[model samples]
Target: MASMSDHELYPIGDAARRSGLSVSAVRFYADAGLIEPTRLNEAGHRMYDIQAIARLELVRTLRELDTDLAEIRRLLDGGTTLHDLLTTHLGIVERQERTLRARRAVLRTLIKQGGTTAQADLMHKLVSMTDEERERTIDDFWTEVGANLDVPDGFVDRLRAMRPVLPADPTAAQLEAWIELADLVSDPAFRGAVRTYLRDTYAAPEARTLATEPFQEFMHGSGAALMEELLAAHRAGESPLSGRVQRTVTLFLEAVTALSGTPLTAEARDRMADGYRQIPGILRQLDEEDAAAGGPGYGDTHGRYLALVAAINGTTGQEHDPIPYVWIADAMQAVQPA
Candidate 1:
């Protein structure tokens, strides 16, 4: 149906020149089925009509955009839409960008912290966790702590609620906090402390004596009473060695006695007071955890747990103020055995 002029076709060289591509590129596209030549001259040369010239230009443009030949062919054949291709590629680009950003932050933080290998390893581990992975880390800690124990209903949920949900784009400080928290939860000493708290709170049925009530009620009463007393002492600036502050040791002992479901003897009181001496040490650990977490956000998950347990057990001593604990212990030691 072509007239003589209409059948005029460009050779591969002319087509490549018009499309700003090399002759080899045009030949490659043709061989790749991306370009269908209008005809083959008798001399065995590929010839392109106006339509073929336009297709060659499209192939050249797609190649410049980094589109693979097969994908370009799919686009040209209308087998795939430009929108779908770009959308899928865009998602991939965004994810790569996010990963790059995280890596950038990790390196930056590592350098600022003196570029130590240990720091780099730790930060890299923290950076590798996805949001879900971070959540699982917290869950795993609680799981380990709660294993083989009669954890009260809602206790694990409360602990989960305290978990810090690290931001998708975290700051250096947040990263530091996350790193510290992750390390803390993995510590054997920390896990043992948590287990000890759980054991004391939920005394095993076989181990139960007449000295204790239900764990929750005891925790609430003991926590409320101890907190009220300590916060008042804290507010009043009472010296731990003062007689007035020391006398409150009896109140503390009574609360412990009420929970233990046993008679409050001088020896039992002394042992309980000895246990209270550990409060200052534990508080020091919590303070370190808090400091690492950049001073509290999800309220220091470990700190919250310890504070709750301490309050319930009537040993709510401030980390920096060991006076109350010292006073209580001294007072208990002074009491004569009947």
Candidate 2:
């Protein structure tokens, strides 16, 4: 038609130059049926009309958006409606955007902290977890903890609810929190503490008598209070033999009795007293040696221990309080020579 004649035609080489693609790329697109040339010249060169060039530009744009050749072909072939294609691609783009945002936030945090290359590499690794990976990480942690215990009916849901959802554009604090959480879960000492708690709870003759209600209350209340008192005392350079420390221990023991709904017999109470007597020795060990110095080290041991305690007591938000199991294990390890 005369109207088609009005449109300028360019040879494949010229079209490639104008479209910012190589001739081979143009040939590939043509072969893929994405952008066909208008005609073949006398010398057998491909000739593209203005419209074909425009379509080639669109193909380039789609490629930049990471659309695969098959999808592009589907769009060109009308096998897929543009609306459907765009809707699907939108999700992909959004996910990629989230990943990029997380990476950028991590990089900014590292930059602000003047972090080492290793730290930067760690950030990258954390940011690279897919949605499935994140879900699996959370699920695995909860599953391991809940394996032996009679977790309440809605406990799993509650646990999931408590999990912090790291945003696509996470803050530096969130990133740091995630990293710490990851480290806490991954630590052998922490894992061992969790396993020990499971074993003790499952192996106990009074397992059914271990009421979750009282345990939860004690954790949030007196147990947390005791930990706070101990941490404060430890910080204040006060003697473990001090009256204040004794009073705190008594209060903690009374709370444990109240929660368990049983009176502590004189013998049981004496054993508890004996445990208190060992506190100063344990503190001395923690102060004298690093966590790695013995079979159980205190280096990061204290922090890791506290994190476990907080997690179990449901007071994990309380800073610097070690979980009881972790504290005991670390104490035992601290005494053993590496």
Candidate 3:
């Protein structure tokens, strides 16, 4: 053809504008062999046709997704499908999102607590630890606690199995939980509490007897439906005090009282309610003066500590709901206690 219509070709500036790239970028892509000038204009200036403009636009989009230049070229050459390119980049973005969220949570915690430089350094280090390091830390914690534990009936084995596994792409809450767990386990007090719990709760004769009670079996049988409903709420991150949770707890308490033939006395119920009310305060009163200041919230019990471990491992299941026992224990002191 002797000449081309204006609509069929674009000047370099026009092509750059249409493709959402700077003039230099369009020229660079051309130099990279990803695109090319269609022809020279009457003034001998490089120009691109409609097809070249479309290719430059695709390059701009892929680059915006953090695609490397080589990958972009592969995509241009039809060496990779668009679906493959997008799928790969989507995974990259998701991983980046988790990393950013973890970093943001760390910064937020520091900001919220007015954390010391040492605290900041520790938080950073804990969040950055390799998987092997995390496992080693957990192992050390268990080793110390295990020395005092005499739990039988596979309890010790199950407890040991619940070590943190921090997921390949952990949620913000999971990352936060792991940080607190790391801090908590590194504290001697927390390890001691675990030992004390194992001795006082699991190894106790009456506690062991209670473990095999008919009601315990009922809980896993008839009560599992209610338990699973509450568990679903927990997994969805619903507040324990929500109306739905209250209803579920009420149902659970009724079932427990009926099955155990132990009507919760009004006094016991009052004590339980008072205990539950104190939980929020107790959780906040954790070792504020130590590295574990943000440690083991939610009643500040080893129960919460274990919950954090379950969270990082993506294995929370059949979690105990403590608030309802408040609706059921009717005891109290001059002040609330954990």
Q: What total of clashing residue pairs does each candidate reach?
A: 8, 7, 9
Question: Which residue pairs collide, candidate 1?
Answer: 210-261, 211-260, 211-261, 211-262, 212-259, 212-260, 212-261, 223-311
Candidate 2 achieves a global lDDT of 0.63
Best by lDDT: 3
Q: Name the 10 consecutive residues with the lowest summed lDDT in model 1.
A: 206-215
In model 3, the number of clashes is 9
Candidates in descending lDDT order: 3, 1, 2
CA RMSD of each candidate after superposition: 13.5, 13.2, 9.1
Residue pairs whose backbone atoms clash in candidate 2: 290-298, 291-297, 291-298, 291-299, 292-297, 306-322, 309-323
**Tens digit per residue, CA lDDT, model 3, 70-100:** 9988888889999999999999998788779
Note the Cα lDDT for every prediction shown: 0.67, 0.63, 0.72
- Local accuracy of candidate 1 as per-residue lDDT tens digits, 74-193: 888999997887776677777776677667767776666667888777778877888888778778888887787565566655555556665555544455556656666777767666
- Predicted model with the maximum TM-score: 3
Model 3 clash pairs are 267-330, 268-329, 268-330, 269-329, 269-330, 270-330, 271-330, 271-331, 272-329
What are the models' TM-scores?
A: 0.41, 0.39, 0.62
